[model samples]
Target: MTQPLQIGLVVFPEMTQLDATGPLQVFAGIPFFAPDPGAEVHLLWKDLEPVSTDAIMTITPTKTFAQSPPLDVICVPGGPGVDALLGDSEVIDFVRSQGSGARWVTSVCTGALVLGAAGLLDGYRAATHWAAMGMLDAFGAVPTDERVVIDGNRVTGGGVTAGVDFALTLVAELVDRATAEAIQLRIEYNPAPPFAAGSPATAPAEVVEDYRERTAAYQARRIAAVARAAAARPTP
Candidate 1:
């Protein structure tokens, strides 16, 4: 607990914007939490350059791996770019180093795979995007499918949208229930979607099938990347 909680959210090409931004918004607003009234957010990348995301927007890194200060929380977001990240020693090493000292190690969506690749998820029960649930085992993680999953100091959000929930949960843990509720209410973090197509269990079967088909090639590549990363992971 300090005046400014240092939080770093990883950035890379083709990452799901919401995966990082959802948590970023929550962390950025942490000053509103009276109990712990300050939080410094850092967008981390290999360099201080603009990184494109799947949402078509771009995020410029506020800190590079070499320049990043010790973080209280380290979060890696997931997307198509995670495939390359899975095998990226630099990114993996950065995550591993941060996670080793951070109070919280987290991810949303396929970013869990990157954490897994970094040898951080072994024996941990973590959550990720539904499509990547089974991939956790490659990193010795017990696959979970909940909106948010917390195992010790490790916290993971299911998919992109789950990042907000994940961060609020962290707020509650780091600050208090009152601060978290106040922030939630101030942000009007109410969930009332028009359709129930969020999850495969409720989504139209045809829609699920279509999506699976559409992303088959991409998923295959991600799976292969996970395998390679797992193989390269140093045994503990």
Candidate 2:
């Protein structure tokens, strides 16, 4: 019998809920496409306690760092909380260890920052939230501005909702395009944004400026965090 494909979706305090849950909904549906798919997703954290998200939601981890089995996939989700994780040795260590053995290492939004901090993204062309694209340079990662990017075993997604696309892409690679298509249809993945303001290229000049101004401080902090994390990485 094929061993179950173990997937670990990391959770941390103040992480954006959608970054984690969106991909989760897709991976959880694996059995629907292939009976006995042998896929299991685990919510991983430092402990088993519930952690608060950036929004009002709270999520509880299904496995602690110490107890998690060898996983086939390691997924890190991002939000403002990643600022602190950039310098968190415990979190970085867990990611580094798991990624060494996992078949795939991935991130959503700024979660790529966490993977970079862990030293897994060095020389990899990765994707991240546009606002933080420039920050990837601090960790030796070439940032690509796309909804999803796959370089070797490293897969990354852009901001928030892009997790779904990332998950579907992963599914297609793992199973088959037909299975992925079936899953997409089941989930009704068609998208029709009400406005064209979804990306900076299409947004009004004033809107872009306002967002830059609003996020300036946070972006600065994130840059500093990435630098610190990079400097502290053990010499390879």
TM per candidate comes to: 0.97, 0.97
Alpha-carbon RMSD, candidate 2: 1.1
Clashes of 1: 0
Off by over 4 Å in 2: none
Tens-digit lDDT track of model 2 for 11-50:
9999999999999999988876765565888999999999
Q: List the residue pairs that clash in candidate 2.
A: none
Model 2 misses residue 177 by how many Å? 1.3
lDDT of 1: 0.91
Clashing pairs counted in every model: 0, 0
User: Candidate 2's error at 1, in angstroms?
Assistant: 3.3
